[model samples]
Target: MRLLLLAVIAALPAAAHADEAAERGEWLARQVCSNCHTISARAPAGRNPRSPPFSAIAARPDVTAGTIATYVRQPHANMPDHGLTARQAQDLAAFILAQKPR
Candidate 1:
């Protein structure tokens, strides 16, 4: 019973942290990426040809959440460097990764 209680206690914090992360990600996506890309279901009209949709990005095998975050922080090529901080990029990546493929 003690072990079970301890496990439950440990899991509670993890669950809370995950929920917090998800919330942060969602907010970041809405604020930062929604302007250029469709970050959510009701994104603003105006698509850029520069990058794929967030859903497509999420489904990409080569680009994991971490990779996306890194790229967003320091973009390459014609992509103008947005200068997103590490935490902002991480949150955006988390939001993008949470999206389901269409």
Candidate 2:
């Protein structure tokens, strides 16, 4: 059983890291993104027609992690630039991607 236990222990860091990223991303979304964007499917009803839901963005064919990272760093006329760091952008991207429709 030692070998099996060692395997599980060794495998945990990556999973934990991903979980941490998703958590940070959710927090960032709630604090910053939620102001204009609906970050979930079951969010406040009657979303603003102008802003698309995060789930929809996540589900889009071209919305990769890199796409999200780039968007967060750049200036958009509508979106408020939170001036997120690379790690923060990565975390948010992971969170958004995680919300993709199964």
Candidate 3:
């Protein structure tokens, strides 16, 4: 029983970490990117006609996870700075990268 309890304790932290990561990812996507990009697997069209879907963005071979994070941190002149912190940007990037091409 003690060994079982210890195993559960060890697994609990990992489960919590995954939950935190998923929550952060969802928050970042909804708060920041949902307006312009579709992060869902459903691939709903973007609200902005000019903006591409998240799947499309992720499909680009040249755009790696690091590139996405950097771009989010330093967007182009036309793009408004959403004022996301570094950690938020990284979390957002991870979320975006997690999306597989539909």
Lowest lDDT sum, 10 consecutive residues, model 1, at 40-49
Compared with the true structure, all predictions reach lDDT values of: 0.75, 0.85, 0.74
Name the candidate that leads on lDDT: 2
Clash pairs for candidate 3: none
What is the C-alpha lDDT profile of model 1 across 1-102, one tens digit per residue?
999999999899977876676679788767666667777665664367665678778888898868988988886784567788887777777778877576
**Highest-scoring model, TM-score:** 2
The regions of model 2 sitting more than 4 angstroms off are 1-11, 45-47
Rank list by TM-score: 2, 1, 3
Kindly report which residue stretches of model 3 are placed more than 4 angstroms away from their true locations once superposed: 1-19
Per-candidate clash tally: 0, 0, 0
C-alpha displacement of 34 in model 3, angstroms? 1.2
Q: How far off is residue 20 in model 1, in Å? A: 2.0
TM-score of 2: 0.80
Q: How many backbone clashes does candidate 1 have?
A: 0
lDDT score of model 3? 0.74
